[model samples]
Every structure is written in C-alpha cells, then in structure tokens.
Target: MVLRDPLRGLARRRARWLAVTAVGLAGFVVFVVAVAVYRLTAADPVFDRGDISGLIVVFAVSLGFAGLGGLRLRVLARRIRDTASENGFGGWLPAPSAADDDRRIDFGAETGRLRRTTRRAAALVLVWVALFTGGLAGMSLLDEAAGELLATGDRVPGVVLSVYDPGKGTPSMRVRFGSRTAKIVRDSGHHYHVGEAVTVVVDPADPEHVRTTEEQNENQFVFGLCLVALLLGLAGAPVAAGAALGWRRRARAVGVTGWRVATVDVVPDRSIGGRKRPPPTIHVRYRDGTGIVLRAVLSTHGAKALADFTDRLAWVGGWGREMAVLFPQGPRRPGPYAVPAAAKTPRAASAFRRSRR
Candidate 1:
C-alpha cells in the first residue's frame, strides 16, 4: 500500500490513531500495575517480612514480560518491512513500497466524505467524554485531599488552661502546647470549659500555624492524592475543553467539499513552553469556492506533506458556530485552526469509493 500525494491525509490519520493507541495502552498498563501494587501492599506494612524479596521477584517478572513484548514488537516490525511490497499492513493502510512509484491510486467508493466525517466525529466525541470525566473526578479528589491535609497532616496536642467570657455569646480559651501558650476563641459548637485536652496539629517549622482535627484516624493518602489529582485535573481540563470545542465546531459546521492551500507560514515560537521548543508552528492558509478563508495549524511534517494541496478535502467553519460561546474573545477574532481538515484530498471522481466487502 503506497500513499502518494493524493493519500497523504491517510498517513496523517493513521499517525494520530497510532499515537492515541500507544498512549491508551501505556495508560492501561500503568493503571493495572498501580492497582496490583495497591492490592498487594495496602494490607501490609511497607517493610513486612519477605517484602523486599517479593518486590525483587516482581521486578524480575515485569522485566521479563517487557523483554518479551519488545521482541514481539520487533518481529511484527520485521514482518511489516518484508511483506510491505505485497500488502499494506494486511490491506488497512498504504505501505512505503506503494508510494515509491508514480502511479495514481484510488481508495474506492465506500471511503466517501460522509463516512470519513462520521468516523472522525465519533472519535472526537469519545475523546472529549473521557477527558471531561477524568478531569471532573480529579478536581473532586483534589478538593478532598486539600481538606484532609489541612485537618490531620499538621496537628499537635494542646490543653485549655483557662476560659473567659468577654461579654459576647462566644467564649475564649487560653490553650497551652508544650511551653507555648496562645489565646484562642472557642468554636460555638465546641463545648470547651477549662482544663480540657484537644489535639491540634501545628507546623513544627512554624509555631503560629495551627489546625484542629475533627475526623478520627486521619486520611494518610491526602498528600499523595492531592499531587496526583492536581496534576490530572490541570492537564485534562485544557484537553477536555479543546476536544469539546472541536466537537461543537463539527456539529454546527457547514461542510465544504474541498480546500486548497493558499499559503504556508512558519512563525516564531511565542508560547510559554516555546522557549525550549525550537520548532515553530506550521500555519497553512486554505480557501474554498466561496472565497471564505480558513486556516489550520499543523505540524511541520503535515504541512510539508500537503504543500502540493490540490484536490484536498478539508472541513472548516466561520463565526456561526459555538466558537463564540466557547471563546471569550468571540468567533469574529481571526485565528489559525480549522477542524476536521487533513493534508490529503480526493479527486472529484474518487471522492466516493466502492464499499469494501
């Protein structure tokens, strides 16, 4: 299966699919390992008998599995390389050998515009749902962790030495912790008289910092949960938002049959993280028969591959969709990024292909 200029879009689509699959598989592996570790160790002390030897055995087993997986991957790659000239990944995608010649190719009538749109839209929706759900759960966990860390992780013991009334309904107490004494107002619900013992967690490094614990046993995983949840929530929020915006755009967009590249711009990296990333964004300008201009921010490889840009079908939208609702700056603002657009397009006759049985 060789992909020529007409099929470069397929390459881009497959690349994205492969990247996402790799990430999903890696995440599943990590989650399974984490669950197994928690199940195995949550019931026992960190340094129980035979724990060190057990961990060593587990490490060895894991290493062996990884080696085997790597070997299998290599074998698969070798097979792909050898048989690539005859078949393309068992007829799914175009092999490198197919693109070596200058022969014009067609994917058939079944792989039509409507089918492509449906497939891309469904994938985008699934991604959006997963990201939004994960982010929401992470935020809730983060809040709970913060509360637990405040209440239990920093407490010290204190004794109420004296109680006094200042003419108000609320009473005050002088609490003593070690050699330090501090005046504190009693909470309206707390029935504290004089000479009462209370557990107050205080920062050892900071004497002024104090907190009282109401919950018993305390949550030991608060700090770890907080860090993990914070990271997940922060990372997933933007991805979820972007996916949702893309989903909405596709839902409300007026489909343009084909788009031609008007220009390509390689701009300087201006983003915060761009200081270390030397690769600038590849911004491609596209226009349809209506003279309406749309743009796509692509990777350098995608841009380079689409430089010919003839007969390429792309999906783009203007100010009419939910872009105004999602973006505070409004949809009238000019920006470079078109949804559902790809680097490849089909000729008018080949746009519709026969269904593969």
Candidate 2:
C-alpha cells in the first residue's frame, strides 16, 4: 500500500484555500458593483421585492464562501500528526538535538497575556449582543406604531395653509383637511410652501391625528440604522468566538507540566502577494512511547525565535492544538506557542513522563 505524505497533503490544501479565497473576494466586489449601479441608474431607487431577494441571495452566498475560506486557513495554521512515517521505523532513527539547558522562559508574562485576551474577547461579544438586541427592539416598536396609524386613518388631499419654523424643533406646517386645520412637523429634507397641495392621512376618531405621505416614509432612516446594527452583530460574532476558542486552547496547553524533545522544520510560506509576510510556520516532529512520529506547528513568534535553530532540535511542551517551545534565550512569548494534533495518544503524555526522568 502506498503511504501519503502529510507535508505534501498540507501543501495541496493550502493551494486550494488560496483559490477559494480569491473567488470569494471576487464575488463580494461584484455584489458591491451591482448594488451601486442599480441604485444610481434607477429613477425611484427603492428596492422592490425581486431586487431585495436577489441582493440577499448574492450577499449570503458570498459571505458563506469567504467564511469557508477563513475556516480552512485556520486549520492549515495548526500542527498535524504524521502517522504514515511511524510504519517505517527507519524514518525515526535519528533524534533531533536538544536546546541548551540554560534556556529561560517567562511563564508568568505569557499567562497574563492570555488572561487579557480572554477578557477582551468576552467583552466584545457582550457589546455586540447589546447593540443587536436594542436595535431590533426599537425597529419593531416603530413599525408597529406606524402600522396602527395607517390602518385606522383615512387618506385625503390637504392644502398647506402656512409654514413656520418651530424655533425649538423641526419646521412646522399647518394643513387644512376638509375645513379642519391641523399643525404637523414637516419631515426633514421635504420643503412645504404655503398653498402647496399634499396627501395627508387623518383619523376621524382623533381629529388631531394628521400625517403626510412624506412623514410615513421618514421611518426609513431608523430602519437603516437597525439594519446596520444587525449586520455588525452578525459579522463580529464569528471573529469574537474564534478568538475566545483560540485563547482558551492556548491557556490549557500552557497549564500542562513538563517538556518534550522535538525536531523543528520550517514550512515554506506560500502566501500570495508581493507584500512582506509574517513569521513562517515551523513543523515540530517527535516520537512518543509508541514510537510513532507526531508533528505540530509552532506559533508565529515562536517560529521567529527558533529560525536559526532549524538545524537543531528544541524543547517543546503542551497537549493537543496548543504547544510551546523553549529557546536558549528569546522574547517572552504566550501560551499556544504551537498547535498539535487532536488525537489523544501516549505522545504528549509519554513525552512529559520522560521529562520527569
């Protein structure tokens, strides 16, 4: 049976993700252009049913693609175990060199950083929830009140008798509705001159109740604000959740005791664009008690610190998608210095057990 190379698989996955991300971004640009053209060219720019439905579909599909691409990118950032290499014992014959015994690590500083990250993430989630809920409630109340007024009122043509500035508030206008004159606040951006004929909605049960066609449509501004709030909440929820999960995993890994000896290999960065790239990912491979070779990806900062030591090995610790490396001397780094495989094995346990000896 032919065995698959884990490194080769990772390369292929990265390429596929890059293509997917490009397509998603292209779709978003198209959606934006379509909206701008539609609004600018139309005489009455209000979105009809068909227009709204089509826009929603396009936006949702584009968002889904972008979200999927991001998820795949995250997966590629973590460390993965290479099981195929275990079958061939020859591949694990020579162990990597270890770090100097005098290496220093600042565990306290790292822990503090993680704590701050967790708190920030929690606070962001709460803020978004509050904004989304308040906006939705306010919009609902406004719509209900407007609906009631429209249902109980009658439409009639009224002549504007006079227009005056209220001094303390918006401009006001007096309109005669079938011999009964009532004062109303003029809607913003709408001008009313004396003797101008306008359509008014009035309730016979309450003679004082009067509203112009323009007034009824004024609620559009409030609706727009609510829609913005909802969109922000939707977009921020995923980002906050992802940050929380990542930090939590790092905290757990840092809490683990003991360290293991592992060889570090730098993965070639395949990121697009000519712009400067961030730190490259390092692959850490080690053999557990079962003699299986397990691999994990080191964090960006950790990769930078260990760049010169690619020819040698280093001291690694932690379990699952969270691991850290110790150098002879480098900047103080946080937990989750690296991410390992999810599969539970004697790999991490045995490595730590040996550290005690």
Candidate 3:
C-alpha cells in the first residue's frame, strides 16, 4: 500500500528504530551473561544460589522481550502506514511515502535524544557501582569494629558482654551500628569475667572477617543484592537510550492528536486491581486545554503498539482522532508520520471525512 508522499514512507524510519533496538538487546544480553558468569564462578554462596539465577533470567528475558517487541512494532507500523496509504485520503498528514526517497528522516536529533537516556542510565549504574564498592569497604570496617571489641581479651575493666536472655538473664551491652543493632548472646557456657570488656574478635582486614565471632553468614547477601542491582542498572542503559531516542523522534515527527504527552506505565498486578492479563488498560485519554476529557478503550496490542508509533498517524480534525492500526506482528508502519505541522491543514474532502468519522 502506498500513500501520496510522506505518509507512504514511515516504514523506512521504523526499520532504523529496529536496528537501534537490536543493538541495545545485544548489549543487554552480553551484560547479563557477563554478570551471571562472574557470580557463578565467584563460588560465593551469596552469588551461586538459585535466586541469583532467577534474577539473571529475568534480566535476560526483559532485554530479549523488549528487543523483539521493538522489532515487531517497527514492522507493523511499516505495514499499517503502507496499507493505509493505498486505502484512501488521510486526514492531516500527506502520505509520507510520497516524500523524496533520498530525504531520510531527521534522525540526528533522535539519536542525540536517545543518547541522553544513556547518560542518565549510566549515572545510575555508576551509583550502583559505588554501592558495590562501599559494600566491600564496609566488610573491612565491620572486621575492624569486631576486632576492636575482641582486643580487650579475657576481661577488660568496665566492659560487659551481652548474651541471649536466660531464665536468670545476664546483662548485655547493646552493640549499635547506625540503625541496626544486634544483641550478642553468650554462646552456651561462656560468661563474662567480672569487669571484663566485651570485644568482638573481628579480622582487621575484613570487617566481616571474623574468627570465633558470633555473627551469622546470612549478611553476605547484602553485597550480592548490591551486585545484582549494579548489573541490572548498567545493563539497562542501552535499552533506555534506544527507547528515549525513539520517543523523541516520534514527538518531533508527529505530535499527538489533542494530547501533549504520552507515557507507558506498567504497574504490578496487585497495584492495578489484580489484573490477570494486562488489565484496566488499552486506554487512550485526551484532555482539552480546558477540563473536558475524551477517552476510549483500546485493545492490548493497540496500547503497546501506539506507544512507539505516535509519529505515524493521520489526525482527524476537531474530534482529533488519530488512526492507528493495531497488530501483534508489528514493525507495522501505521502511516507516513503524522503530517508535518506546516502541511497539516486538511483539504475540504478530508475535513468532511473528519466530520463524518
């Protein structure tokens, strides 16, 4: 299907977006695999568990799904626009395919926009990296604190050791670190010598490094969580960048019909009324400058597909309904990107169609 000019050509641009998404997916895969390997090999109980594997799997799936979904969208948008072109007169937009073949869509601005997301994502990843570093550093600090407590060997004056509550409870000095406090308990038969200072025998090299210490090994998971967060954050950078760029391009090409902005908000099932299959969704709402609101329910495919194809619609006047064809196999070109604003004034016949449809 072919439209007059601009409307017929959006499919080509969508192809470009698919390419960008592909690169992002590849990057994400590499990142996840790298992290998984690191953890699997570390032989750290914290890293080698099934939970870590689950996280890795989730991360990989998100990347793969996003990439494949993007590819599909581009394809569908291309198809929709191409087919719509041959059908009939489009409202505000000129058939984009009618544009000169050599005039590529202005992707430079789009590319820059996408890069901004990378910067933001990269900064977040950097923060995670810092957190991971801090965790390692903290282990050493913990060892120092424990060692200090242990140093007053046997008995030190004015010192008290804490122990689990007994039938006739022994007094325990509270060990507080910031907000978290742990009550040290006498390991069975051990009792504090009178006036003996209670010290934790912690290795100086590692705060977590302890010998004859009474702390649980469960704490190592904290470092593991930090490590996972770091990996996920870093892995997401490229995908974020690609998505941002794609949106920026759409905004520049086709401003939404009667709406200034759009967003794809995903919430947990519990948050949205326990939706079993992506519920209370597939909706489009429009608000006039005043308080009037216009909305309609959309198909699930419509919801996902529309998010990326904002640029490829022919707007109806007054009512401002934009025609977007929904499809599961995307990369469907819904249209030549919304007609350029400069060329958007509808002809008499299109105006008539707008009034009627």
Best by TM-score: 2
Q: Which ten-residue region of model 1 has the weakest summed lDDT?
A: 321-330
Instruction: Kindly give the stretch of ten consecutive residues in candidate 3 with the minimal lDDT sum.
Output: 285-294
lDDT of 2 by residue, 1-357 (tens): 112233446646756885787577668756864565444333246987997898899888887887898788667645323222242212222232343132454555655555566677778878776776666566566655555667777889999999987667557788887878877766445787889998888767875666776664324457668768856764665556555655655555444333555555543344577442435444444543222222333332335444334534554544333444544344454333433322222233233233223
| Each prediction's whole-model lDDT (CA) | 0.39, 0.54, 0.38
Instruction: Give the lDDT of residue 109 in candidate 2.
Output: 60
Count steric clashes of candidate 3: 49
Q: Write the per-residue lDDT of candidate 1 for residues 177-288, one digit (tens) a residue.
A: 7888866645434677677887765655655645455322222354345445435544544444444434433333222111222333333344586352333322332332
Local distance difference test, candidate 3: 0.38
Per-residue lDDT over 6-46 for candidate 3, one digit per residue giving the tens place of the 0 to 100 score: 34345455556666666656666566556654543332326
Which has the higher lDDT value, candidate number 2 or candidate number 3?
A: 2
**Each candidate structure's count of clashing pairs:** 16, 1, 49
What are the models' TM-scores? 0.31, 0.41, 0.31
**Full ranking by lDDT:** 2, 1, 3
For candidate 2, the TM-score is 0.41
Assess candidate 2 and give its lDDT.
0.54
